[model samples]
Target chain A: MTVKFNNRDPVYVQVIQHFKEQIAKGYFEPGQEIPSRRELANQLKINPNTAQRAYKEMGEQGLIFTEGNMPSCITKDEAVLKSVREELIIEAVDLFLGSIKSIDVPLSEVLEIVKKKHDAESGEAEGSK
Target chain B: MIEVKNVEKKYGKKRVLKGLSFTAEKGEITCLIGINGVGKTTIMKAIMALTPINSGEILIDGEKIRKESFEKITFIPDTITMLPQMKICEAFAFMADFYKNWDSKRADELLQFFKLDSTERIANLSKGNMAKVNMILGLALNVDYLLMDEPFSGIDIFSREQIAEVFTSHLIEDRGVIITTHEISDIEHLIDRAVLIDNGEVLKEFSVEEVREKEGKSVVDVMREVYRG
Candidate 1:
């Protein structure tokens, strides 16, 4: 899959997001070996140097890990997974809080609305299954 | 790799670029960004042999480049380089003859993607379309690198997005692209690395994430703070 540069946010961040999306989609399983720098760069149509930066950032973020000559792989660390999940939840919570605050809506009303929507969506999914 | 070792350029009394040195590895897109009139385009010109450097060493793939190597790289100056009256097809044919690697199929596809009427004269098209056409040609030429100066300038929002996407697909792996522009917001996400230029000198160079991680700022907000100071 070729990586497209849109000149909107920055290239390295987009690469990081791409990797996360892949992981979330199970395109890359936990502990799965990641592609080498050159291979990933070629596949994404990006510079190897940029690809290197993405890998480095992923390692620092605990999304991926490297050990000796065994190539980098997705991290299956429970603690790291918990942190990422929390981060995603925090972002969603912030947005949800912001919208409710802007309209001066009460927390009770917002939670009730969220619960209703969640139930409806899960109900639809169960019916489909 | 493209290296600029102690390169210098000046116009009359004003020095545009001051002994700058940086390397753009193959398959990377390095964006030269700065406030208005910071010599971003000057660097691109020096790389493409359009303008002479006052003093410095310019190397491409570790070798000094010359006129013969022009085919190896393509340059699109911020100011549209092609003649205004040149028809779209005429410009395409001209480049095809100039560079042997020019892909006619790709060129045809890009022209149509931009929705440029080849039969309609270039002068007749709006200024925005002209910029789009200029970019389409530079990108369609299969080369080791493509250097673009302000490809998004003089264009509205819709065309900018369309043109950017087209340029994105034209990039071949192992080939680098350098773009210089003042409007960093729109194209900020497209660049692999951001090179900040100021007063003819490079202030900083980092991946998009590094800037955010280290400075705790988005590129747009950081740029505003940098230039305002």
Candidate 2:
């Protein structure tokens, strides 16, 4: 629930991004209840209007839903959830590729290093578990 | 809405407010930002009718501020105004007697929220506790608009953060808040709009989110461009 927000980006946009990341990471399950805009504002130490705006945007994007008097909940649609995960993966890979492109390394060599790093990190995670 | 239109103020030969204008809507926090002596406190005082303005008009909702406006608005000065010998509960009794809008229940709630001991004397309070007590005096009222002067200034970072938390909590409700501060880094995210002042005039008045959305800039970035450009 804690987010160290950057000052430059619109706070509502950052909030939406945070929600998307949580959904993609499986931390927010499908159809899970979400905090009310006011509660979110208090918890995040952000303006209530910004939190409201973020919720409105999320509703429009089908990332969350509200029904008569009930608290808003994460979208239960599988396609939307799948797309959110794909979107985050693509974004992270694009950023990584952009950084690697500046170094002019061959794709084959870069993929080999990526595979090795990924395996080592996953192995550590497994050992910890 | 609290409308301050083309307001001007003077002190002896010096002009403090030069046709400053801004509107603070209910349910939003409008910040008056400037360094020391740029007339931020002067504007708050003018709105409260604590001082005379040379020209222009100040309005609450639509009508001009009057004796009854005190019921609709409250001002929290930077310092605690209670007697040093008074206990925290005694100060609450004083406020309850003086202001019809004072809510003793909410005052008690704020005392618990701040973790302030009701039996503690004002003279024994640390600077941080005094600031919190000052805030409670203003906030424990059934008023629509709240004006605060330098609530975070000259306090510890932890105290500053605690005060900042008040802005986001239900304690504020939908009250129109006009807060003056020379320092904004701590509560920048909590305000709806910022009115940047320099030399008694508004340099820029903008919605904080709109600036970030449209110009890709933070409040500090705009301040740098306006103040140093």
Candidate 3:
């Protein structure tokens, strides 16, 4: 798929975040073979060293693993998969709350609006199906 | 590593580079960024020994630049260095005859990658195509370092896109690349380090990732602080 990176954060960090997002969305199934470091660098137009760093960091975080000379693959650990899902949800909620905290709207109104929007999106997904 | 230590240069009575020093490491892309008339091109020329520096030293892998060093580093100037009358194929032949490191297979691959025709005359090619040919000639060489002077400058958007695509390809990997450009956005994500220059002096040298992590700033943001402030 498509990953759009912002200019603010370090690219390697963003790359890790992109993989996490993909995994959380069930796009990258557990044990799926990911692109090699060179392939990742070419696809993202980043330096190979940066891609290597991203993969290294991902490995450290248990988001991916490598065996011998084989290419890196998504983590098959259920604990890591659960944590990744929780991490993304927490990040999304933190962002949502941080943004709404500065506004004049009440929490109840914001929750109602979010609920309506969520239902609308769910309805659209079902309609498409 | 390509190191320029305390480089000083002058044009007639005017001093251009005043104690300029920077190191571009192997396996990384170091960008030399500054406004016009700030000696960006002069630094590239000095590195190539095209214009002799008034003082200081430039070392390639810890030795002074010499004829042998020429085989290890390739410099692609902004303008056409080849004879304007020569076609793309003839230019390739000329390079092959001169440089022992020239790789005909790599040149052929780059020619196809840039979608350049070998029979097309250099003089008749558009500015973008000329830039591509210039890049192809340099990249076809098996060199440890590549110095590019304004590869993205004065080119069409489509040509710039094509050139940007080449940066990600395997063609230029694992080489120390020193690129001087005012248009930083074209290769912003691709560069590993940024050396900001102002009035012949290096204002700052920082890794792009360091700036992004510690200061939450891009190279352009850093440039604004150094140049505008």
Candidate 4:
């Protein structure tokens, strides 16, 4: 999976957001083993301390957990998984609404455009499959 | 910790460092940033004691710099330090001979990581490959503090990316690093603190995260404010 990070925010926060997005998209399934902190740091080209901080924050958020010395895994709790998914959806909708509000277009027109875009994307996905 | 207190240096009649002072704490990457000819390298040279200071003092871990301290700190100059005629393996042997802390296994690992063949002559390698060799030489030594002077200078984008990747890996995790670079974008996210230098003086020094949190400014933004203003 490819994760593109914005330079404006703290890197660990962006790393957590990337993992959240992956989890919400079902790319990282529940109870799947995630990369170790060092591995993640090496892959992302961030400081190892930043990777450790990201993992710690993710653990605190109940998004991932570690057992003994084993590597961390995605949360297996259905409630946590559902909340993570819903939170991402809400965040996307809020961002979309905020951006659209700055323009002159009405909400209904923006919704229509989004519907067309979504349908076209899903159609392309089905064709590829 | 490496601390420089009111350090001053001069060449002939021209002063290079004018009462410059800063601290690089243990387990942190502190970047020394400024435009070219702003004495960024001068400060690094003074810290390494490669160049004599006119006044003031530099301390590594609360002790004055001495021959023994040289073993504790490794300085990687921007240009290649090894003889141009030496092959990569010969350079490695040179380092192994001089430094008691040199780890040949680590050197071999870094050589493989940088995709450098030990048989290649240093003079024949590309600019990027030469820089990689320079980095590997400095990193193979087990030292508490690593001072890199413009490690990113005059390198290609791909080489810079490879060197930047080293910051994240276990290769540099425990040491206190003080790196001087005019190009901050290459290491914007990796640095813990930035010491902004202008005219041989530290204009400002602050933790990067604190600046991001309090002022919503990246190191580049802060540089613009300090330099442009």
Candidate 3, residues B1-229, lDDT tens digits: the string is 9889999999999999999999999989999999898999999999989999999999989998888988999999999889999999999999999999999999999888889999999999999999999999999999999999999999999999889878777877898999999999888888999999999999999999989999999888888998888
Expressed as tens digits, the lDDT of each residue in A9-108 for candidate 4 is 7778889989988998999999999999889988888888888989999999999999999889999999999998899899988998888888979778
lDDT of 2 by residue, B63-140 (tens): 899989999999999999999999999999999998999999999998998999999999999999999999999999
C-alpha root-mean-square deviation, each candidate: 6.3, 1.1, 1.2, 1.6
lDDT: the better of candidates 3 and 4: 3
lDDT (tens digit, per residue) of candidate 1 on A97-116: 88778898778988899999
Model 2 stretches with alpha carbons more than 4 Å out:
none
| Candidate 1 per-residue lDDT over residues B1-229, each given as its tens digit | 7887889998998888899877787777788888778888788888887789999999998888876677788888765666778888888888888788888888788777778788767788887888887777877877888888888887899888775664345354468888888887775554667788898898777777566656656777666666686
Model 4 clash pairs? none
What does DockQ give for each predicted structure? 0.17, 0.83, 0.73, 0.67
Window of ten residues with lowest summed lDDT in model 2 chain B: B167-176
Error of 4 at B159 (Å): 1.3
True contacts kept of each: 0.13, 0.77, 0.62, 0.60
Kindly list the per-residue Cα lDDT of model 3 for residues A34-96, writing each as its tens digit: 998889988887778889899999999999999999989999999999999999999999998
Measured with C-alpha atoms, the lDDT of residue B58 in candidate 2 is 94
Tens-digit per-residue lDDT, A12-116, candidate 2: 999999999999999999999999988999999998888999999999999999999999999999999999999999999999999999999999999999999
Quality of candidate 3's docking, in CAPRI categories? Answer: medium
